[model samples]
Target: MSRVPAALTALTMALLLCSGSALAKKDAETGAEPNTQVPAGSRHYAATGFPDRLVASPAQDAARGFSVAWRTDTSVKAPVLEWVLAGDSPDVGTPTRITATTQALTTELGASHHHRADITGLQPDTLYLWRVQGQNTWSAWNQLRTAGRADQPLTLLYFGDTQNKNLSHVSRVMRAGIKAAPDARLSLFAGDLVSGGDGQDDSEWGEWFAAAGWLPQETAVAPAIGNHEYFEEFEDTPQERRVLGRHWPVTFALPRNGVDAADTSTYWFDYQGVRIAVLDGTSALDLGTAKAQAAWLDTVLADNPHPWSIVLLHQPFYSPREGRENTELRDVLLPVVRRHQVDLVLQGHDHTYGRRGEGQGATPQFVVTVAGPKQYRLSDEARATMAPVGEDTQLFQVLKIDPSHLRYEARTVTGRLYDGFELTRGTDGRKQKTELTQGRIAPRDCTRAQTLKGRADRCWE
Candidate 1:
């Protein structure tokens, strides 16, 4: 008999204890009671572990094939998801079991596990009710809708950074972001979902999921690996190699198209009429990302034919913070984006908000936003690069892409539109930008260094 690895043995013991407890929770409506308590170190959850913050709800892949992911307290049994299309009646429910899988991992804080289930085989542009089941106990099925077809126009949500106070203030920002774009087809998380090393803890990751709720499950999500996604390391290359990026791939199954040199986590996918390219700025700057990822990115962009291309990453190529600009990534990837006519670049890390117009003949527009509780100040150099900077605490953005034009709006957490613009791409082969009739959403200058420690302040003047 072969001996089991210590980690596997520990996880198995934990899972068995958890399964016994799951068998005890009586079906609320069924009223069938069980006799055991939830095991120690275990919690019942939906475990949408695949993609963390981004949702590909109206995914343009198969007719009605949408994907979802979550985490679990222990090593779970085989993933068997049951789903049925949701109709006019919310009560409509029926579940067909689909096979899924789980992967073991150790996050920054400790050991952890996640599960991802891709639900396919459904009608086009329709809603579906789905839930996860492990150890014979199932999670509540949630409502999700598929994409309207390739030619259909769609709306998506883009936030700056959601890395601070995940469950409290940051959650409000996310909820407000969701409410602001109630009909948004999907969301793009441009890194900083948590504080990176500190946020990699099992509970912090859970808080992030709890904050997003069924959003990531219902809507399709695409997340970028930010600086916070990595641990605090010195010059230990071997240690860094041993600590390969975590929780990302196991949490969301993204389309494998972006920078292949990196993990599938940093990839791109097209939904409806838009092409989204995800880049790994952190890897490119510190790791050996420039060589491998750059080549893959060039190929992906060159081959893409989507009408609009948006690149997402953690660091800003053009920033309000002059010192923080990613020159290396800019040198390697910017030309690709320009050559491929990339439409937008969304990023976070400086914690401030910014937008800069790409040079002549280029359609790519750059934006930096803060989705988390933390914020930063826009220095004079940072302000020189960007137009209106959001240095104070509250900000987010919503992007609506239609057949005629693409609309972008920057808003406060409470649903007030501060900045707005429209990008109209016509047969003339030029994307004309129109500034909308909205007030600026810049942060007040009254903030001080102490109060804005983790957040950005109003230092642009």
Candidate 2:
């Protein structure tokens, strides 16, 4: 039997804590934060009595309906969302107003108001100008296009985890993706958009909003729940529990069509010809909601009406990181995914890029990517798999889907193509694939990134 001194144990624990904190330094290091929470930035806009953090989200049918949510100082008693169709005439049409549902959230930064407005009854595939009322000012008139008809071609931007240093390192990647496709319809985030979601602080949300500037207001976003979206039960308790972040529903007025057992964060919506099915992996993995989510996923996929279907969540069905596997999640969702033959499954959390399965009818493409600066080790499976896995690089994806074909390109923040594929779907939904490797950049062995100035602290950790 061995016994350690109390003072020695205390010193050891302190060193461990300090070492962990170093990984989350504000500077742009590489590697995954490993469930670290990025601290809040400022309260300047929060106390200004003006609306900020404006985000437009997809409705069950974005063609005719959508939602927008914003934050403001609590002093702003009344906040309203107004919209009008874009016209050739300088004078916009008489704007229709929707009073907002404002809720107050008191975080470490103090009290702020969150306003959400779900609007419907608009014409499909139409361009609209919208803004939210602030104290006496209004946010810039944001232009957004509603989902077009089913036969129309569609473009979308997909990013993995932007969970750490959002404003610094992750912002440019977003800018690059948007620059590549200025008219992208929906921005699909695989989860962990922010590093922290414990509800005690709202600053990470601030950074996220500041990072994207006005992008969120233009392209609608569909977010899934990552583990970081869960809050620590208590500081003193050694055991960790999953509590959904208070800012989630307040940040985005997501569709309410998910399973009744889960909250609004886990829902599916159709945009143009695509059916985006999002699940709450954090809740399923930690809160004993696997069966609930699995059942909902089955029903949602079974009745999908769109030609192209994709699933978004935080955890991947087949993780490419070595020594890490989400068998539980795969078990719960894979059967449903395979049964319905989902076209693609997008995930984050692993903070790396890897893909498994062919992008076809029965074999859906399973992809994991990281847009934030954090890097992770690549798994042997990833190296073996040709979905072209890599490390030490931040990436974003642009996907264009039409009636019978889908073209996808994954590029680094510097605008270099890393991996690409084109799929041609037959009448039966089965797709023939073509690889786009010409001019593709070489892959970096980021799995050992810590050695190279330590990518956010090597993902091999």
Candidate 3:
């Protein structure tokens, strides 16, 4: 063999390395290896093993317990959480550690892991710092405050569907809600958290989590599963055949004391002096869980240990739109609510703002609101029944509960009070409601000439 030039040998080796790299890139893009993990650069938001989508939910007991759920890449087989008392100064000491129960799931993006840990033995009304550990990394410290004992005044923030334009439009509304009620212990989501196909769209979920920011980690969330949570095979398919999204159960570590142990989405929890029951309206109407949920609701209400009771569902009994009537759910669940004299019914799915209830007696007040950019025109029925039907507007609500009274306020995205009311219960058990909005603002009508995206009459067809 003749002696080759040193530069020529180096050039030949570099070309070979480049060719190999190109082949590897092509194989990754084409998924030539089924078991190979997807490249992080190709993933939506490039999710990693470090915790993301952190959400806290009230545990079996809110006063001394709570749970946190987060997602990580598949590489993290066992995730752990560490916590210590939150203080002004950094005190180096051993902290309580808890290992999370994890589930491996393959999403549309790729394989991922969901981890949940229930932390108990916490002190009431105390703040704590916590962080989650992945295989080789740890998340930044997050703060959590336990709920005060019963009879203590509590505040909660309520939001409607954040399914459309979540990151761009809905994020502002949620941030505004948190800023308005800084002391709120929990945030209630009225469902339809995402509006992607089959509810497994990784980008949509990423946007949803990004819009939520640090709020979910700080304040606990109680969410209901809306009709959008269920994916239909075809538009012509029957409602009874709809199926829940694959991410519904794994993403949320809700209370499992519901009627069907398999479905923890429908459950109840008591905080302060109020009892909140989360019902699966989609399951009730489509999955043949109505009767069972009704029975469960009756039993839960009958055995209630709290004076104030509220029901959270995705669909409204009194539909805000013309063709969105959920007659089956109303027929089966309304009777139970009436019998129990439920204090309030918070719902979503209409995409418009509505409020209707009988102020005379024990009828549960109903509210339908939307928090995202998607808006729909209110039907004639909504206009006739709802006191202040709002369209083409995003809103959030704050509810303050005390021993004898409850004050509720609805505000627009910019923090303007749109509607408000107060409920007072007397010693003799007589209840009265006083409307707080006295011609403060007119109902938003999209039919009027309004410019949106450089188009006139954007709210109507």
Candidate 4:
């Protein structure tokens, strides 16, 4: 027998070892398992549809109630949820079971069922474990904590436009935000959760839910309706003629205190002395519902008994991007918000970070932020008016509110604090705002040399 060359043998062994190492690394990164029995006509990510995308939202009363939404295969006729007060161990069994209201629909990914269950009678400041039962399987037990008393302090995680490049880019920021603010009572999204319109794109929604991990199972989510959430009659049609996607109302179990059944996306919920109101900007801008929503907003704010009020919407009254202004929306909603003395207005859709109302006494602080990978140049107007204009950086905001003070911090995707402030209320119900950037990292700006590199530029260090 002829002996093989030693160098050739070594090279072959090295190649095999490198291939094995790469496979191992990929597996560790993805936690993906092989499925040999992928069913026919099922998308790669839609196999089994075994109760995925589980999310918890605030019910009518967050302190005593919570709502959960999940998806399963269409075969599941009667979905159910079982919950119990979580003890110290997973051995706790046989939780109270409740039937979930389900809606069956066919999407681009095929036939699927969406289930929502409103679990009430929960004790405030208590932890509970819950799981959903589908056609023949039950989801793993997920734990959630109820809202505390009105006087208790509250922390909330805010993200702007997790619309483009959700899984590849935005997932890290979502995970980091959840890790950094583990005690946050709720997660607030400033609209454009997905880039696709009319819910025709299942992959984007899948990336969004998958990136969120256990957040939806734990903290409640309040998402506003962005323009991207609406779809035009055809891709060639004008944007102002768009309509609300069918999936918005069915996927989220939000509060129903809006103008009408079709406008339920505009609603409000209170938690720990703070009332958060979400408005459907797409509906208001495109469907001529601005007047109706503004009336509803006034009513909600007038009836609110909380110490702090935060309004969330997609379009900003003070446009952050140049040549992009929603004067109609601003004209109608700004007066109502000012009349009610809203503390903060979180917005998105400009794909940049900006702040207005800094020196205006008693005026609501308006913020525009972007959390996804997509970036846009600051409009000339934004550069002239907005402070700390963030262009190339993905960001998230951590907000803490108490009876006397409200703290706000904006951080990059890599967990660096970029901008922050503190708002203190005086005895006369006036607010004194203070910037909290002492010794903190400065804002990031891209240089001319870096800008030449196109999207590959790393503007912020």
TM-score of each: 0.81, 0.88, 0.86, 0.86
Model 2's number of clashes is 7
Best by TM-score: 2
Question: What is the Å distance of residue 24 in model 2 from its true position?
Answer: 8.0
**Better lDDT candidate (1, 2):** 2
**Which residue ranges in model 2 land beyond 4 Å of their true spot?**
1-42, 197-200, 235-239, 358-362, 447-461
- Compare the candidates by lDDT and give the number of the best one: 3
Scored by CA lDDT, what does every candidate get? 0.66, 0.79, 0.80, 0.78
**What stretches of model 1 exceed 4 Å from their correct place?**
1-64, 88-94, 106-112, 233-242, 441-443, 452-461
Residue-level lDDT of model 2, residues 354-450, one tens digit each, is: 8777544435888889999777777777788745888878999999999898888899998899988887889977677777899898876653435
- In candidate 1, what are the lDDT values of residues 394-437, reduced to their tens digit? 67788988666888888888777667788998886578888776
Q: How many residue pairs clash in each candidate?
A: 30, 7, 0, 0
The local distance difference test score of model 4 is 0.78
Where does the lowest 10-residue lDDT sum fall in candidate 4? 33-42
Worst 10 residues of 3 by lDDT: 32-41
